[model samples]
Target: MTRSRLTPEREAELYNAVLDLLREVGYDALTMDAVAARTRSSKATLYRQWGSKPELVAMSLRHSKPVDISQIDTGSLRGDFHEMVAQSDDCQMERDTALVRGLSRAVHENDDLLQALRELFIEPEITGLDTMLQRAIARGEIAADNPALKYLSHMLVGAFVAHPLINDEPMTQDFLRDYLDAVMLPALGLPAPGV
Candidate 1:
């Protein structure tokens, strides 16, 4: 799909409005009309730019993050992981976690949203992670055939969901930093942090 033509400031305004609506009413309840009204743009323009509500929501979520995981390169897998954890502050992580949790239920029931998320958000993230892993393999930080490479994304994503579910608190940067040091590194057959 072609990218949105809206100016950066206008696009940010629209994305923020969409996120606010998502927070207030969730994906199921959010409507194109509401987004149009909220952003003060006609529905046609929104559809023209984003194609649909699911795409709009997915795009909004992709835009909300301050960093793109794909672009982080710290010259080592460990450094890259640390950079990822350090990208978001505690409060932003909490909000983003809650937003994702809210979208999870909706994604299951809506095929469009799922596809949109995969195309606009999830797939890019997976690709970025794959690149990061490839770099690790090239640097000899982890063996190319390390079994844990296959499950790395699952482990990281699990860290996000499992923390709130198991610990009853949103996962923070500190928690993720420790998780990378203790779990992810060891699983990849690398020494623990500071070793």
Candidate 2:
């Protein structure tokens, strides 16, 4: 069947409907028919805009809110680490909810979706963190070539995300702060203040 063309706004509405469907039904059970019904659109329209489930899901994730790393600076390295931990904690709490778990499952099932998500959502956040580290280096809070900078993103965000998925405990600010002080700070060759 020939597919009808959609306006940009209609496309965005359909994409949001896909996200809502994913949240409600999960990736494995999500269907184009359900999405079309929810958005009051048609299966042909979804197919015309995005050829498959992976493509549609990937596009929805890509258009989701972008991360903002604009507020990160505390006079000393320890302070900066604390601020970063707080920022990461807040970001995780804000964005990495059950919906993300659904998206994660989708990506796991589809290689193309996985690649698109990494390129669109994950990489940019890492790049923004890298830029923040560069600023710290310029301010001499950290060595220009510190190895810790290489591991910062994973240490700050990855561990938190993994713990709940692996062990089922919610990540709290207290745990994050303690982790930064005991593990991350030392790994970077920096000591917490008064230590």
Candidate 3:
């Protein structure tokens, strides 16, 4: 936590501090002073390094939840989607949902934060899934220009995002698997799992 240089461990500590504060206070209520105090870094250092709160938060997100589209290729579209859900940390769903819900209001109101979120978190996954769909189309399993392809991101993410609003139940790993098999696969005109 030096003024001019940050070791790798120190940087990670700072990022974790930012993410933890974000979870605790949400984006709107979080402040640079809080981040500085939590990370034991000076406010001037944060400003000099990141320039603003949104940028710092964005960098924190990008550094922490890096996009890795390459790991998702399971040879078939169904397998890929299944792997995506299966690989998710079982306990993380609730925390992830809370973070999403907490950021929901602020993301809409702040263009900078929204743009950063889209670039860092949203679009990478969407683009990766879109690539997977295109691969299916090339294999002739999915028809080219299928309407379902257009809404794939919403279809997958909305299940998690809208679950609480639609019902009292939280989206669990089992629920995601069931929803994928029942709703998503069918919507894409894919055969049922294990068929």
Global lDDT for candidate 3? 0.79
Q: Write candidate 3's Cα lDDT for 1-195 as tens digits.
A: 233587778888998898889899999999999999988779998988777788788778766653365467778877777777766665667767777788889989999898878876777777777787887778777788667878878887798888867887667888888888888877888877777
Q: Weakest 10 consecutive residues, lDDT, candidate 3?
A: 62-71
lDDT of 1 at 153: 83
Residue-level lDDT of model 1, residues 44-105, one tens digit each, is 99888898999999999889878877788899999999998788899988988888888989
In candidate 1, the residue pairs with backbone N, CA or C atoms under 3 Å apart (3 or more residues apart, or in different chains) clash, namely none
Cα TM-score per model: 0.95, 0.68, 0.86
Among all windows of ten consecutive residues in candidate 2, which has the lowest summed lDDT? 64-73
Better of 1 and 2 by lDDT: 1
Ranking by TM-score: 1, 3, 2
Model 2 has an lDDT value of 0.70
Please give the clash total of every predicted structure, in order: 0, 0, 0
Predictions: Cα RMSD each: 1.4, 4.8, 3.0
* Candidates 1 and 3, the one with greater lDDT: 1
* Cα displacement (Å) at residue 158, model 1: 1.0
